[model samples]
Target: MSPRSILFFLTLFVLGITASAQYTEKINSNRPGTSQGAFSVGNNVLQLEGGMGFGKEKHKIFDTKTNVFNFDYTVRYGLLIEQLEIRLNGRFRADGVKQTVGANEEKINRSNFEINTLGAKYLIYDPYKKPKKDTTNYEALKSWKEHYKFRWKTLIPAVSAYVGANFVTSDNPFTFPDDPAFSPIFAVIAQNNWSTDYGGDWAFVTNIIVDKVTTDNPAIGWILTATHTVNDKWAGFIEYQGQKSDFYSDDILRLGGAYLFDQDLQFDANIAFNFKDTPSIFTFSFGASYRFDWHTKDEIIEKPGLEGGVKEGEEQENEEQEGEEGIDGEFDEIEGVENDSLKLEKTPFINTFEDDSFREELEQDLDERRTEERLERERIEQEKIDKKEGKKFKKEEARRLKREAKEAREAEKAAIKAEKEKQKMIEDIDAELDKMEKEQGVDGELDDIDKQLQELERMENELNQEEKEEQKAEEKKAEEKKEIQEEDVDAEYEKYQLQQERAKKEEAKRRKKEEKRRLKEEKKRKKEEEKRKSQEKKEDNENLDIDKELEIIDN
Candidate 1:
């Protein structure tokens, strides 16, 4: 190509770079740490992350010293938002080795640089931040929690997996990883992020990894990271990494933080401390990511999803406002215009230069909007705390009530047991009394027999006669018992006749009393009627005598 053509192409490339820079995008990174997060930059975005670390190692047997220097640069391109990404990331490592036996010092392979790994990560599944559905207001959407809607704190982890390889580019005799070959590395990742009660975000990321570090030996490792987002611009993380190989096992703890200058750029620093050694590595990195449109502005009218439609709507509103102002201004100009064919054109800059009204409004409200967001987050945090506390209190109250009910039942059982014991004691006393009464009766019988025995002793000669008398008495008693039975039957018959005579006398007495009552009633009734008739006759005689006296007077 000619010089002029090359210059033109370079100018065109620079213009393209400027155009791409105009399209701003925000990317959440998962780098400058051991564990990978289940997230991606939006489609057609370019992200680059780079870091460097220095390490020193000491040996006791040979009294050797080694200094390791490392650098890594990773580039990621998002094929699909939150779904797929292609990454080219690798590390450049150099080691300084020193061998000494007390005073015998030797410096061998003073410096070496080798590319450590080149890998690609593909996200397989995400319980959050996947399926990329656009919220109604993208700017208003704060977190991806709503996408999951609900999650079990212990059970649901956003899961992902990726496969990659590591290749050694340099063939240095004294460098580590003597084989210049590729090693396959595969990992299954589980991650989760949650907001704490104090309005901070906490993230947990874990990886189960298998990698072929040597030709014949494969290494199995695990990485666990706990990340806390202190605020919008600062995030701190603590990580544990352990790898087991055929020869040895090594463990490391990484502590780090990232400062986000803005959504599109970040700076990070971290230190990795080995369990075998005191401090293994220290790293610091700077990274930036950007997004741009694949098509020119003239060809593409709107963005995708909700944010896309928002731009069009804002433009339409501005246009309509300008149209209304133009109509009004043109009509006023027409009233004084001399040329009938010419129409006054109203342009934003024609009359005078003025401040950008929209820009001014944005500048004025930026802090106000930030304050509102902070208050909203605080309120949400309080709600979560109150809900958790309420649940705890309810559980405690239920447990207390259950305990009380159990105690009540135990008390009732104790009362019933006491009542049963009392009844049993009473029954036992009654049985004991019955047994004592029987024993007393036996004692009384024995005393009567002793008295009879003494009386027999007083008359020894009459004892035989007494025996004969007892025998006769017994026979006589038997006959008497039969006679008594016959007499009892006769008495029973006489009792029956007496009962009949008594019953007859009672019936006659009742009848006599009833006849006397009836005669008394009849006599009283006759006396009352005769008295009434005599009174009435006397009243008539008095009236008649008066009349007769009057007649005599007249004669």
Candidate 2:
């Protein structure tokens, strides 16, 4: 391609690469910037980003001024996996070139596809795929900053690789006369996303691209972009791009911002400019990005909970059903064993005395009857023992459930008492604040104090609501535990008792801390009130003295 055409193609390539490499919950559009994110659009998602722009380029050496209009589009589809995407990027430009050769002016109009490429990108490494384990010190006595210390692992960036082929038709006006019909392009992309203490998230993306390697005039380029999420709906970016080739080389800068219209759509506007007398360029573009999301939620297998921990609601119900079925099966087996013993009792005595001896026959019959009676008695006794054990197990389970229920009730009562105390404290503070406001005539400071009191009440309500929810959760957990195996019941109950004890201790500590804080605040308020009264009295005394002095002077 000619240098101007090369420049235009490179610009389009830069624009097209700006898309995210991975799927995001919110449509991560690469629009309004010129650096590709190292993430994909996610599997089964189709995204389209397009822009139209007008530009002016002035070539000093050729004494030519060109007015350019271009339309660029990128179609990206996540395929097969979350980390892979196939993309089609193309740009068409129509240019009106005006040249002056010593008072001879010439006009040339050229229109064609300046750049077209189809590529597949795959993420090779993702630093954020797995979250780091939290290791911060959360002790009450630790400094607050200790929880937010910087993690060195965050420095690693997600990286991706892209390989694509560039297509150029023969005799295309945008290409050089000797340019090949097809060439290869390759790129390595890296991106880092980090959060600032100011609550804004920042992203930096870098792309190293080698385009048209098979062509006689190959180009190597790099793009660096820094993006900041201003808020939930707005983002801004600044980018720098540099490219070098035998045919064309220049540095370009871009600034842009995007608005998240919704989860799957974005609107953006950007401007790009280059510094060079040989061919100075400026462009402005407005674009929008939208996606057809077909992503499905991935199935997640939860890890097993702690020992003696209850399962989820549905799982717990299933477990309970299974346990009941097992108990029924055991009962059936026991009945089968009893029937087998009865079959033994019904067996006829052996006819070993074949000779017709009445005495021996009578004796045999007696002995057999005695043996049958003894077997029957033993079977009845075994049945009684089994029934007794069953009853004992049932009684134990019932007692455990009842005990847990009682404990839960007691805990609820304690919580309610604490909540009442908190509410009384809030009411007293509100009453005191009202009295102060009435006495002080509703000044700014008093208004601030009232606001603070209202805030405290609001927080108290939230805490009460949380506590109620937690209690409900605990009740549900206890109900689920009723299906625990007979062997595990005692162990689980002991563990739960220990947990309750620990929770009581923690609650006591929390109450003590709260009471201490409240007293400190009350003391501070009283001291401030005393200081204010003293100041008022001193002011009144001074006024009286001044008034007396004035009277004496008049006399």
Candidate 3:
């Protein structure tokens, strides 16, 4: 490729270790290095980093040379949460070659894209932190390698492994299709991180890789890297990578630096040097990387209420720690006051120049003063407790008194009501007596007439008794006569029956006679009427004759 094409793409790509102390993806990119660290992007996050590389090589086999212009694009996506990740770190390059045969020159062009590694990373183990009973002593906190001084990576490391394959996804420079163009890479990786006071923190990453297709020998490669935070926005690192190829064994050492343009964006650059004289290759890289979530993690970061509960959890823990610190402080003060042996060990006598007698008296005075101070504190605490209890007791007593007073008032009202009711009952009895006296028509005694009437009624009763005795004698005689009548009772009954029959017959006859007499009178009256009518007729004739005579006379 031409220098115009090579120089225009001077890009160096880098990835950050992590965003913060919080849970974020880690990038092991030193400014320009080829040592991938033992970390992946956070769960559900994506990372893209790209850069350009320029390569010039001379060949001894055909006396031909090649110039390569290339761009490298790295991609990493986290899966299965942080436990697994998928990565594609590849390069797209164009190669131009020049060859001469007996003064005739030939130029050839070859361009293709190659994936350096497409792989998955699995986490096997991570750091384990033991509980700290006393946080005040930071040394009491147990970690994996805290005992191993100066060995930073052993302190606390997360262990992981990776499996990948390198492939060239094109057909070129070969007449046949049956060629080995793919290789498998398997490796184990580890990462260790620590914090410093001034420059933030540091991380060390190491990987042991096995490349099956580097040659028929199946080469082993290694990368050991160290990262240091320059400050909040800047960081730097050094990396060492080495492997024995079929032709020569080479080692690469790289130095790089990174700067944070923003919280979400970072820029980095590095230069790499070969350690061998035979096959000397130089590499330089620089680029920037940015990160973001699909939705607004800013809401959680700004409000602390959207998603990140860890902030509040940490805050609660800090508050509890503060409370424990306060209690520890109080205990320290109390210990100083109580542990007289400590004071004595520090200074047995305040007045060293004084005589023994005087020292004794001073010590006694000091003891008394301490005693008084302790007594005062106890008394103050007691008073506070007693004040609350006293208020409670007072309220209870007031309630009891109010209840008693209410009961007494109710009992008094009942007594008064009962007295009134008793008086009303006595008055009712007296009123009834007065009404009876008035109805008697005498004030205190019955009238004399009433007594005389009673005596007269008694006398009449005696006379009635005498009349009853005479009636008894007459009734006895009538009984005797009835006994005699009983003897002929049947005959007398028969005679009475005969008389009744006769009377019935006579009544019937009288009724019949009366009926016959009414008919006879009716017949006699009819005959008399007939006779009178005839006589009236005769009289009428006579009157007619007289009228005629009168009429003749008048004529």
Candidate 4:
């Protein structure tokens, strides 16, 4: 690849290391230093940052001494998005130059805008935009090392791109004689932020810039900065800036600190120096940053579910309603059948062939027979439905029990594994302490090691306590599940008992009807035997009268 292509790709790589733009509750300012931050001020926020400084420069080649007074300012306004901002940056410089030309000294004065640029920066990549998942339930089970492990994702920084134009008028003292009226400037910015073990936050920002691209003496430079946030209101930073060009080449270092006065304001101070003896430079500066925030709260929109365009909550409610309606309908159908049978049993079945009192007795008997038959059919059908439902309930209960058992086993195994790991770590630490003692004897390092061992022991004790709490929670859950199972069994047993009582009542009614029918049959049999004996006696008397009539006729 050509040098230009390679440079373009390299710029992109460096830009990938920058910080993402995000709206913070407190004003975020790049101050006390000249390096640019990757993030914008925030959408709809206008910020002003400026500084004033004095410096002295001496050039060995020309035997010239110069006194410089400079003021630099940046007016930044977040545009249509949080990730984009437009800024106006300018530096005004006044210089008094004294030169010795062969012992004939001369003094000259020059003043102009050393740098003025209008640019817009847009964030291209943001690694921190995604939220981290919550793992509170399992956090206590994790080892100390695992809990504090470094995340590789943090290595990927947020990146931003900057494009601007430098407007230099004719005969500017700060620019090369061959510089054009308008020159393009392009930059790639990157930043990485992470927390230290000591609870402090660190931010590293990088900027790769190509300035005055249209001019004969184009400059390429880079700025690297490291900032540490000591507390809520105090922060400190160190920066290194390097520039290379046909016109000038120099390296500068700066140290600075900032104090947050309020949510919208900050104060900062910094000192800068260069190592080059040709024109060794030193400067001190103080600055303040303030913002006018006009951002509003973002609106929240909920998307519909994939199936049937229903919302999740509404879909769940509809499912529950349908299930309830199904169960209710089943019960209603059974109750209706039962109510009809009951009314049939209660009403008298009239027997027109019998007397009024006998008809009433007969109706009662018939009604009992019909009621028994209807109830038997109903019981059979009900038992079938109950059996199916019971099977389903049993299957679900078994699956639930199996799942709970599996989870319990896994938890037990995890606890055992954690215990073993803790023991091994303790052993290793002890061995290290013993080896150190043999090698160096007891000293401050040994005491520090001992303190670490104590801290480890304390951590182990906390882990054990957490394990006990987890065990208690599991036991409580199991007890509640058992109670629910017992309640279900009690309900089933009560239903069975009710069914048995109904069967017994029906059987007793059937036996009473059989006894009444037997007595009616016995009374009818006795009446028939008496009638047969009376007819036999009347036939014997008629035969004797016929014999007497025949003897009188013969005489």
Error of 4 at 114 (Å): 0.5
lDDT of 3 by residue, 15-131 (tens): 223311221233433235566666555556677777776766565567777776778887777664545778888777787888888899899998877546799987677552221
Q: Report the lDDT of model 1 for residue 176.
A: 43
lDDT of each: 0.56, 0.70, 0.57, 0.68
Tens digit of per-residue lDDT, candidate 1, span 243-311: 667644667667788888876677888777654432233334444433333311111211222122222
Global CA lDDT computed for model 3: 0.57
Off by over 4 Å in 4: 1-25, 132-141, 196-199, 298-555
**Tens digits of lDDT, candidate 4, 180-298:** 88889999998776653344567778899999887888899987777777778888887777788889888787888999999899999999887777898988889899999886422
Model 3 TM-score on a 0 to 1 scale: 0.44
Model 3 CA deviation exceeding 4 Å by range: 1-31, 58-65, 99-106, 128-156, 170-182, 198-200, 213-217, 247-249, 294-555
TM-score of each: 0.44, 0.51, 0.44, 0.50
**Residue pairs whose backbone atoms clash in candidate 3:** 12-285, 12-286, 12-287, 16-27, 17-26, 17-27, 31-269, 31-270, 32-270
> Per-residue lDDT for 277 in model 3?
44
Query: Residue 226 of candidate 1: its Cα lDDT?
Result: 67
TM-score of 4: 0.50
